[model samples]
Target: MPKMIFVNLPITDLDRSISFYEAVGGRREPKFSNDRAAMIVLSDTISVMLLTHDFYSTFTRKPIADAHRTSQVLLALSADSVADVDATIDKASSAGGKVDPGPKQEMGDLMYGRSFEDPDGHHWEIMWMDPQAAEQGASAFEQA
Candidate 1:
């Protein structure tokens, strides 16, 4: 079988987090979901595990850092086009999520990205890359 990745995030509200993920195009896997946690399938190989704080604390000995104030990691996903990136962010905003303040990225028309914060304050970035340019060679924005 092929490898798969599960990004585990501690969430204060299980139901709300599940709703937020679904709003941004994630499909909830009921087979792996329950009151304590929810498995949001971002793709066939990628899943986001939204675990309750009590359940998440069981996995580590250290204190759970407040995601709203800390920047340990940023969850990023690729989109088909720049419009897709914007659409996802817009859905996030309408679902009570917050958009991260920053200029939208554009790598000379080959790439674009936007950022948003989930209801639980987990940072996420949606980006699009030109497939033809990516297959050709190095990006034009790359330094010599």
Candidate 2:
């Protein structure tokens, strides 16, 4: 079995968060979801656990940080192409999510990426890479 990545996030409203994820091309995996939490399957390997405030609090003693005010983590995903990355971010924006003012650019032979923040203030980055360039060990920062 392959190792799966689980990203847990605290949400004010589970239903609303689920809707937001759906609008961004994520699907709910009911088998792994329940009233206290919902599993949003972003991809086969990447899944986000959206937990209610109470449920989320159970996992840690520390207070939940308000994403709107401060960033706790930045989530990034890979894309097949730059167009796909742009479209995905556009969909996020149209679905009530906000795009960050500008994206950081890292030029390379075969790597491209962009980043944005969701309505709930979760940061996300989308990237595309060329397999050939990867094989050649090209680094985006180096090319830039």
Residue pairs whose backbone atoms clash in candidate 2:
none
Q: Please tell me which predicted candidate would have the highest TM-score against the true structure.
A: 1
Question: Which residue window of length 10 is worst by lDDT in model 2?
Answer: 100-109
Per-candidate Cα RMSD to the true structure, in Å, reads 1.8, 2.0
lDDT of each: 0.89, 0.83
- Please identify model 2 stretches exceeding 4 Å from their true place: 106-109, 138-144
Model 2, span 14-114: residue lDDT tens: 88888889988999999988889999999888999999889999999999989888978888898888888888888888877877534654565467788
Which residues of candidate 1, in runs, are more than 4 Å off?
136-139
How large an RMSD does model 1 have?
1.8
Q: Report the number of the highest-lDDT candidate.
A: 1
Could you give me the TM-score of model 1 versus the true structure? Answer: 0.92
